[model samples]
Target: MVGDSSYGAMSIEELVKFFQTGKVVGFPTDTVYGMGCLLSEDCVAKLRELKKGREKPFAVFVPDVDSAKELVEEFPNYINSLIKKHWPGGLTLIFRAKKGLPPGVVSGEGKIGIRIPDFPPLIEAMKRVGSPVINTSANLPGEVPPVSHKDVRVPLELMLKGDSKGGIPSTVVDVSGERPVIIRMGAVKVFEIEAITGKTILLSEGNVLNILYVCSGNTCRSPIAQYHLSYCARDLPLFIRSCGTLGFSGSPATENAIKVMEEIGVNLTAHRSTPISRELIQWADLILPMEPVHREEVLSLGANPYTILPFYEIIDLEKIPDPIGKDIEFYREVRDLIVKGNRWLEKHLRERFNP
Candidate 1:
């Protein structure tokens, strides 16, 4: 906080020196202007007191994602995906804290919020500091967090310049729980989170491979293939779903295909169809198409055909016959072919996604 040594503004070199001397300063984060001090009890106490000692915990900001993992117990799998998607942006993720952080940051909650600020100089300063900063917004308690440097309330030895892009604060989530709980919905939306995470928000048991099956129409082959593959992968952590290339969003799986899948121990009675989406394609580590046509569709979405290759590529077939409106035996035959095709898929998966 500013004091007798108040500096109107400081160069990056001066800012680095301020941090080295155990001083708190005002700076910009991607979300808003921020107040930070070197990670130490005495410095944090000074910062917390200056910032009005608000009840909740402060975030510990690292230079980057790897630094974040260093101060936490375990970084979940989905969290790594999120870090890739939104680091250096407005997203505060809570992880179970490791010791050595200031008590004020953890606040005896045994959880510490981690942020990787998108601000360049701030990130550079953090890199040089070689430690985390007690990253909290620059404001008095219960006031709007400052986006522009002009609005900073906490006194500082120096101020970093920038108009804070203040639209929404960083979205906050606690991944230290059994599921990711949305504690605050600010910059990122639930659907966007789901798109990147390949998950329905707050509805998960643990990390799983997101597999999407693509076909001409969702009502038959794709659903049957995914359900059967899901059945085979029951012991593995895999989330399987199907989509159609024709934009058939709500059709049901053909009755014969559903019945045949049931014979194999996968229940498709509740399967609902979805259309192939850019979101789904992005979400999937592997986009498996039932035919060459489906593969082309996936490739049009900027997908690499190497990843979305047709299942029959393994079985030496030109195409996997669509068994829509077919008798149960024909459906059963296609199911058997798909079951064998998965062996090729397993090998390719190990070489490609290896998830």
Candidate 2:
């Protein structure tokens, strides 16, 4: 077993040799020690064979969100949103696998668990290696995970000493759903991870809630509210959509509005102006409008069953302002107001929908 010391002190050549040879090395993570091998078909096979473990499945640890994105296929916007809020930390997300990864790694489940450790040594090693590393606990099957290198078994110890730069285990968080659920509570506290991801780590299964926004023209306030709500309701599996009262269909969001949103890191360039329709109104559980008049329009379409909330009421309820032909500065002010309103909406949803 590797001794409890900073393997980070070793030269890069030594670290590279160890990983290339497909040896499982113990490294420190933000939470605990982790055993990993190079993430490739051959290396994965060697690690599994060495562990004498079943093809149950395995996770990969990346150095950052960009790397995770490269590895996973068809990652949804919600997944990107989660990474924006919680990665470069201790959260682990399971996503559909892309073509490059070996099927044995994820056990042909078509999904893979990925993590980005916060520790420097592992991060440096990953950066140097230019790919993900196989992540599993540093222990034999049915054995308790080792808390430190000294706790690793004799055979595993030799590999750690031979190859690992800093064999530390990473804290694991499973985000394969609307909210994260902790399978094992380790180095990172559940609340801490939840705070970053903005999603509660559920202990049991439950329903996912959806929220929608509607207005006359998708260009102005509705789409803005949709994106802002996405940030505020980052914790819930809330579905956010925006449509206009009239079909300008295929029109781009106004340039000034896009500028305002981009300031807060929301890309509205792809937002096409979609008009409000009976089907849309019926599809929504809650239809928030920019003004009271717009709410009436939605209600007239038999959308009355869905609650009609004012943008300010759901977001800042008291500060809804007009944004038509406004200056970039005016749009910025409106954007800030919407962000505040979404915060209020978040609290409301959590209290009302949380089971």
| Candidate maximizing lDDT | 1
Could you tell me which residue pairs clash in candidate 1? 1-155, 2-155, 2-156
Q: Give all candidates' CA lDDT scores.
A: 0.75, 0.67
Provide the clash count, candidate 1: 3
Residue range 262-283, candidate 1, lDDT tens digits: 7877888887789888878866
TM-score of each: 0.55, 0.49
Q: What is the lDDT of candidate 1?
A: 0.75
Clashes of 2: 20
lDDT of 2 by residue, 237-352 (tens): 66788988777798888899888888788888888888888878755656777777677788888864325666756553543677878788888887787777777777767753
User: What TM-score does candidate 2 reach?
Assistant: 0.49
Stretches of candidate 2 off by over 4 Å are 1-11, 76-86, 157-182, 189-201, 204-355
TM-score of 1: 0.55
